[model samples]
Target: MSRVKTAGALNKYLHLPLVLTAVFILINAGVYLLNTRAGILVSGGLVIYIILILVIYGRQRENMLNDLVTFATQYGQVQRKLMMDLALPYAITDDRGKLLWFNDAFAELTGKDRKSFRKSIASIFNGMSPDKFPARDQEIEYETVYNRRDYRIQIKSVVLDDLIDNSQILERDDQEESSMLYAFLLFDETELNNYIQKYEDETMVCGMIYMDNYDEAMESVDEVRRSLLTALVDRKINKYFQDLDGIVKKFDKDKYLIAMRTRTLNELKGLRFNILDDVKTVNIGNDMAVTLSIGIGANNGSYNRNFECARMAIDLALGRGGDQVVLRDGDSITYFGGKSQAVEKSTRVKARVKAHALQEFIEASEKVVIMGHKMMDIDAFGSAIGIYRASRTLNKRAYIVVDSPTITTKPFIDEFENNPDYDSKMLLDVHEAKEMVDDKTLLVVVDTNKPDYTECEELLHRTGTIVVLDHHRQGNNYIRNAVLSYIEPYASSACEMVAEILQYFAEGVKLKSIEADALYAGIMIDTDNFMSKTGVRTFEACAYLRRGGADVTRVRKMFRENVDDYRAKGETLSNAEMYRDHFIISVCPSGNLESPTIVGSQAANQLLNIKGVKASFVLTEYKNVIYISARAIDEVNVQIIMERMGGGGHLNMAGAQLPKVSVEEAVRRLKRVLDATIEGGDLE
Candidate 1:
């Protein structure tokens, strides 16, 4: 193909001029017709002129072509010499990344001689893989550290046929057909990366620090030492930030603004924000230790946006209960120092404020749809009832959304089924709720804040206004767009939080005996009959329910288990295995029980009473999902362990659901998580 193309090019450039000259002789015949003597003289002169010109031109053309070939040869030699000893690091590899050839620069840098050069790029470059290479039309670049210098390698894929037509060095010997080859050119980017790293280290990280229990800690100490306690805390915080090359500005008595370089933030992260514990231990004869919540925002592209993210992160840390560090980097959020339980708020002023906000939302809305988590438990049902009661009080149409009510919630659901006082449309299914929602409707989510966990997640997007009321620790999968979000991890139950909100919903908010009973049942069930997580506010909510004609005896009788449930709980307990002499694990039998997951939770709670058990986990298979109920005392933090499996709750009580896995696989995963937790020293 090359020879044909070369011959055609020569014909166009060297033969066409001779053919034109012959056509000129035929035109001279017309001159001969006019004057024979003159035409003969002209023709003779023209023939002589053409002969001399062709002889001279032909000789020069030969010399010109030879000189051109000679120049091309030297040009090719110079190019070959330049590529062989080029200063830039360059190498050739086959499509599978096996080294074919390399320049002196690349050979010297890689210390690869011809004898030992038959290796893949992966062996030469620390992390290169064959699959990481680009295709024939595409180019790829990657960074690696060679020796002590950072190198940027740019790989260009070439078809062998494209190069062989142009250069002898690229000719193939072994391969019968054209194939792809990669040419690698490496640049020393050590100095550039050093500058980039310096800039990154200098990048500002904006954050906010808030004293989680300023008033409570102060009140716990003597009045005279309160000033000293305040001074000590301030000094501790200032010194801590200063040591990290940070600046702290006191915005309020309990709040501070902090600015630090990214390097400082990294140092703090490596320390796991130890200042959280250090600040708590700074007790100047105070009965209650003070805790701190830190929120940091980095890599948000601007200082103001970072500060805004910091504010949002701080709010999240507080919402999940304080005494933690939340790092917000754009859309990603991370938590550390959440080992301690959230401190319960002593003041009801915030509840009153939220209640007032709820009143405004309800009054402005045309209707309200109350929803709860799937497999609705007593706490979920009671919180829905509480919101339903509040909505009805404001003369707005209200409906409770329930999907496939579970056994634990059936009895309470039955209490409202035949009641003539309640409207027939008060209880709505998921499909009905989706149809009922509109721009004028208010969506109130109770017990669970995650949209997926809700009975009708579609309703959240359907309604313009959403109100989230939850007592569990806010997971990463939370309702981000809500008009009012009140997540109190410290509260015993969603019912307790709603009870407080109801107190301030109106001046004279009256609760029906059934409504009071439902609310009472939620708190009772969540707190395990007021034995776990019962703070002053928990009891206060229960007392208010009592005032509203909630009978403790009636609530217990309503939730009492049947014979099968009791037997299942006993079996779970008897089958429990002690892990590491502290943790207990067991499986609960469904045994025709409608709510086997709840039975697992009860079994987990029962396991904590064992002599050396610090935490308990009970697994139950129901509806193709393996539900794990986790319980722990102050000795261990179970929430973090459960979060690994995509669940979250309070420090003592948490649960997770593993879908599309066998019971044996779920148990193996649980054991792995437990082992990882133990190795990580989280339980300590």
Candidate 2:
């Protein structure tokens, strides 16, 4: 087929030259046939014509060759463009891995133009070597950056063996090949990976809700009553979620699953779920209240992980005795509710065990230094003093660290200051406290176990020998390095723990009247004069204090506030607002005269006075910090709510500090978390 085409092309060329020659010959013959003079002129004209024909034939051949070159150039350009349009970065390289050709897409993907690309592929790719690349039909995936854009690139190499073989077909077997060629295809996956990462992040927040006491709520009810209850729950839920965008589905008769976008989560954070107090008031035939337990998972990096976290939070709420809201974010867990009643627990064994452990810890240290939470109250002061007395009995040098100016209990501070035996030199500031702390120094943390709330966080960290005694519910931040930990949430106050430990050490030895009074004052302050949250152990501890010469009248006098302070407390209580059936919220801006502790407690107590109120919370400003106090009347769990704000206490009472946040901002954040708890949403 090739030979036939070549012959035809050659024949066409020969025909053109032959026609020119024939025309010239014919002109010369005509000139000879004419007269002599005319013949000579005609001959010269024929010769000129021959020269013209030859020149034209040569020009035609040159044009054909130019056209062929032009066609080849256009064809190569079209092939390069076609490869680029295929969505892959394409490049041509010689056997030595040197780039010989590349299209616009290749340059764009590599952030290098054709000139730079030809110089060296490794110039753009750091640490890349030609020898490391795989052969034809094999591909490798690697990460690279181009023009500040991160990408996962796929590199492939191909050998032009067929082209090379054809070119060298006539060459000797021993002849060395001059060059080899390879084609590379690079695909950008940066945007795709980013999209996948976004999806993973969104999926991780999960929400869960469980119906507390479902069986109890349904007991004694017929099928018709059960259906009515279910319908009512569904209607309330649908209505509550009308404004929020999320998928709400009934997982079971007593469970629900909800999926929401992150934007929806942020929006839901503002709705105080405490407003759903009416949900617990669902009236059936027996007038029984039905409450829901909600768990929200936050901090999961993926949707499935968040879902699992939400499930775990719900389980924790149920395990701790339901009818509450549980939120777990990372390592921290917060709870709300459990105020209606506390599950009865016996702590006799725990107390005895803790007592033995405390003795062992005391024996191990060179000396014991007792401290309390910042802004020391009577409970903190009493607890520290009790621990100091215990250390004295052991013949160990002891110190009670206190910042008196920051003390909330002015009378208690003054009384300690006036004591003849009190050593002023031993009282250390945070920096001096660090110098005093050592491996041999037994640092006993009283009243609170939270590091941020401690009077001396540096002392806690510096001392290897440590002990913690508190009455607050266990939180994630509870001291972990304590040689001994005696935490009893059921106890009324830290003073109770100190008194109990002192009894174990003294064995009926009488406490001084002042010491006894200070201890009694702590119990009274925490228990609201034994009107709320007084358990059997609390009263027993109080009775012991009374026997030890605690003057009831004197203790009452210590609690008496100045007329201005009293008026401030009364004003704060007057601002309380009742929301839902169970909760009351009040904002108390007590100015400079009122301590946050005083204002928060005053508002909490006043909220309890309202008819049908089960729980009360107060937001108060003191200095630059916003303080929060939560109180409940055996029907609400206030500790969990306070814990969410980085505070922990008993089921009935808890307090927290919000640094650098305005009282209004703290209240707004608190309401959002409360709303999610009351309602149901993803926790993680």
Candidate 3:
């Protein structure tokens, strides 16, 4: 091979010299035709000239090759020297992620001295592997945090032929084989991130603070000392925000507008917004303590949008019965300090006004379609039935949207089935209801304000006239186009809210015995037989139902479960497991059970009776969805817990539905949520 390489190297240099020698030889041959001795001498001279030229050209080729090889070696060394001293963190790794070479900046970033260590780059940076990189164009870029510093990593791939073609470290024989290597450049971004965070912290945030129950609280005190109480409460509020570097302007006697930096908002969240309780501590011989509803908005991308979000958040906070803070950050809405029970209002003015609005909507609409939640429970169906009766009385064609109700609601449905007093097709399926809806149709959503939880979400979009009446605390997903939304989180049951609305719906509105039983059963079941959340208005609503001929004994008989359901409830209690030393977790038997969720709720209530138990959860696996029923006496706010799990309800009574999970997996998820809640200091 050496001999062949030498010959090949000398071949180009010899070509021109040999051609000139060949011409001299040809001239000698032509002269030989004239004189033999002269031609012979010329031929000899030509041969000598050819030998001299080949020898000289071969030596010249060797010298030139030596110079070229030396230059290539020096060039490779210079390139490597430049990379080694570069300020930017640079590294070269093989396809297997083994570091071949690295610059000084890379050594500094990795906190390692220059050495011959061929360690895997994975040890320095986690989740980085050549196998995970994109194949096309052989380039990748991403951001990562290392050693408490942010870095933007960029890596480019190169073949051995291009990257180290003239490298002196490898021989020409070794370069015949092809290999791949990665060049990485890391940019430190810690200071950039800090500056960005500072900019974000300085962004303006706005809020609305309203004195909840201001008139009611003022009336409870004497007219003489009311001014003092108001002043003290105002001072408490103003001082609370002023200490946090915030601006407060009292726009009304009971309302204030606030603006502050986002950093202050974060500090407020960390403190859990104690202002809700601070305002209540201002006691100067007043019979009632004042409560406040604070709503703050941030990250809406515009100042005006932040104010709009503040308005929306304040409305949501008030709708959840006040005494809370709702933070609307972009699309996320967070609740803080809602652990207190909602204060019940003694006056029914809002209910009367809402009833008049409902009367107007129903009377003017061409058709009315009442929608309850899917898998309707007693509260949902009863509230829906109440609205149906109201629509019927208004002389409009009304239909109740009922799709696959639970077994608990089957009894009421059977009563109205094929009856002469009701329309044959009064109860509509989801498909049938969608076809009946139009722009002029009135869509009244009862029991649930969440659009996804409604009987038919498509119907809500099909009609422009939509009214929402729910007793559940509003969560992330709700009807956005509600013409008139009447939500009272303090109410024991949605049926109770509807029952109150029905009284003021018309001059003389009456109910049939069955209808009254349905509504009464709803209140009975939701309030755990008037033993859980019953108040003055709760009992008054029941008394009103009694005056409407609702028989308690008959309603109790209607709620009777089958033998299988009775056994399932017993099984749920038997399988109950204690968690975190206070919460009880149980699973209701869902095998061949139609009303598993109702039985689960009943079982949850039953578990709460255990001594030292703060709350109870019953999970039932039905049709590939885990239905979780949570119940609390007062210590635990299950509404917030359930809401964090993508569900919402009253503080004491909340439920959630998780699809495509096993009963055991559902329990594990519940445990994870409980663990996170405890870590977040939201629970005991």
Candidate 4:
């Protein structure tokens, strides 16, 4: 290649010298051919002209060569000086990832002296070398060895044939082959990141603090000490925010608004917002403890936006039973502490008020349609029946929407179906109900507030006037357009809430024997036969039902398990295994069982009897959908665990459904979720 390139250069510049030589030869030959004095004289003059032309051309060529040499020398010196004096950390690497050369800044940044720089770039830079460059330039953040500071790195490709080290590579090669090289330039970004972190630390975060059960707490104290108790609560709250440099103001009787810096807020988060525990320790002579519901909003667009988020968060915290901290960053929410059970309200004034409003709505509607969640359990069905009775009490036509009932609810439904006084047309299937619904019909949703979980979501959409009555905590997807919503997370069950509402009905309006028994059964099943979540109002509602002639014996017989279901439960318990030290997990074997979910719940309850177990989970697959029943005994919040898997229930007992997964896969996913909850400090 070098010889061919030399011949081409000679051919390009040979024209000037060859033309001069040819002209001289032609003049000499013409003079000799003339053979005369005149021709000889002319030839002599041409010789001088040729000599002058040759000398001028030679001098011009020499000067051009000298100028080229000078420019090359100067360019080489300037390039060398730039490499040595450049402020940015710079380095060059060959195709093999070996470091060919580096500037002083790079050596200093990497904490390597010239003597110690004889290593590969990857080895020196902690293995960040790129084998090939991307088509476009890329900027990356790198950490240096000097002080572990961050650097913004830029790399560009430098072909060997065009690089300053081309001669060195060519000299070392026997069969010359051009290779690829890279030029790296790095700028320190440590200070920039520090500035960003400082801004984050100083950012303002908004929050709201609610004194849950404030009126009840104050009422429990002596009349003379009530002011003192309020002062004490204020002192605790003020002192809590004193060190945080936060501004706190009491906006209402039970609510306080606060503004705090994100640095202190993060510290509070790390400590799990111990204010909830701290306030509980304050003693004002009240038998019941006072708790707090704190909601924080961070990383939002504006202060007002964050404040709005905080307000929504506090509502959610209180709806989920209070004694918790909820942090809302835009659409995502993270919960901190919610260990205490909800305190049942001391008065039913709200229930009475809501009942009156519902009566007014029902009085104006043409007809009423009541519905519950799918797989209607006793609490769901009983709540539906209670609402239906309430509509009848108002002297309006009503219907109960029922679909494929589960085994647990089949007997209770059968009693109603067999009753003579009950209207056979009152029970409507989802399809018929959808057809019957109109703009004037009142849709009262019971047991569950989520539209997705309703028996007839299509009918729900068609109905104009709707009322929501539920005991579960308000979730993200609640029915938003209800004219009236009565959701009390503190209630024992939906039936218990509806039963309370039934008491406030007009005079001479009453519950039938079967309706009373069904409502009582709903209360019993949800409270685990009054063994869990039963409050004062729970028993009061049951007493009212008994007064209405609710036969306990009949309700008990309705809950009796058939032989096949009993066998399924026993088989499920046989496969129980302990996990996470003390929690039991059992996957029910696939079979044509009548009620797999009932068996799963029964099996979960029985697993709690094991000596050291604190929680139990039963997995059962029916028609390719894996159903899980999670139960805990004062040691875990299985509700949150199930909520993470798209299900929700009470704190100690919850269930989840996993679609299109086998029993083994469901168990594996359950374990992984348990692991994450435990690792994330939400569970023990």
Question: Candidates' TM-scores?
Answer: 0.92, 0.57, 0.87, 0.80
- How do the residues 1-684 of candidate 1 rate in per-residue lDDT, one tens digit apiece? 112222567657776657767776776787798899978987997798789778977577767667767888999999978998899998889988899888889889988895567899898787788888987678999989989899999999887775676786666665475578999999999999889999999999999999998988988999999999999999999999999999999989999999999999999988989899899889779989999999899999999999999998898899888889889987899988788888988998889999999999999999999989988998999988988989888899999998878777898888899899899889988888889999999999999988888887778888779999999888678999999998888999999999999998877479999999999999998998788888999999999989988988888889888899999999999999887778899999986988999899999998988998889999999989999999988888899889887888889999998999988898889889889978876655
Of the two candidates 1 and 2, the one with more favorable TM-score, higher being better, is 1
Where is the poorest 10-residue window by lDDT in model 4? 1-10
**Cα lDDT tens digits for candidate 2, 454-509:** 89788877877888888765655667777776765557788987777777773533
Q: lDDT of model 1 at residue 230?
A: 93
Clashing pairs in 4: none
* Best-performing candidate as measured by TM-score: 1
- Candidates ranked by TM-score, best first? 1, 3, 4, 2
Ordered list by lDDT, greatest first: 1, 3, 4, 2
In candidate 2 the C-alpha lDDT for residue 344 amounts to: 23
How much lDDT does candidate 3 score?
0.88
| Collision count for each candidate, in order | 0, 21, 0, 0
After superposition on all C-alphas, the RMSD of every candidate to the true structure, in Å, is 3.2, 18.3, 5.6, 6.5
Model 4, 1-684: lDDT tens per residue?
112222367557745666866787787777777777867787777778778877886577656656666887999999988987899988887666677788888887777774556677777666665644433333334455436777766776665455535565444353666556767788888889889999998989999999988888988888898888878888899888977788899988778999999898888888889889888888868877789999889888888899889988898888788988989977778877776777899799988998888889999999999999987888989988988998898888999889867888889888888888888889889888988899999999999878988998887779779999998876667788899988888898998998888888664349898899889989998887887788899999999999988999998988898888888788888878889788899977657677778778878888888889988999888877888899887888888888888887767878888899877788888999999988887764
Best by lDDT: 1
Give the whole-model CA lDDT for all candidates, comma-separated.
0.89, 0.71, 0.88, 0.83
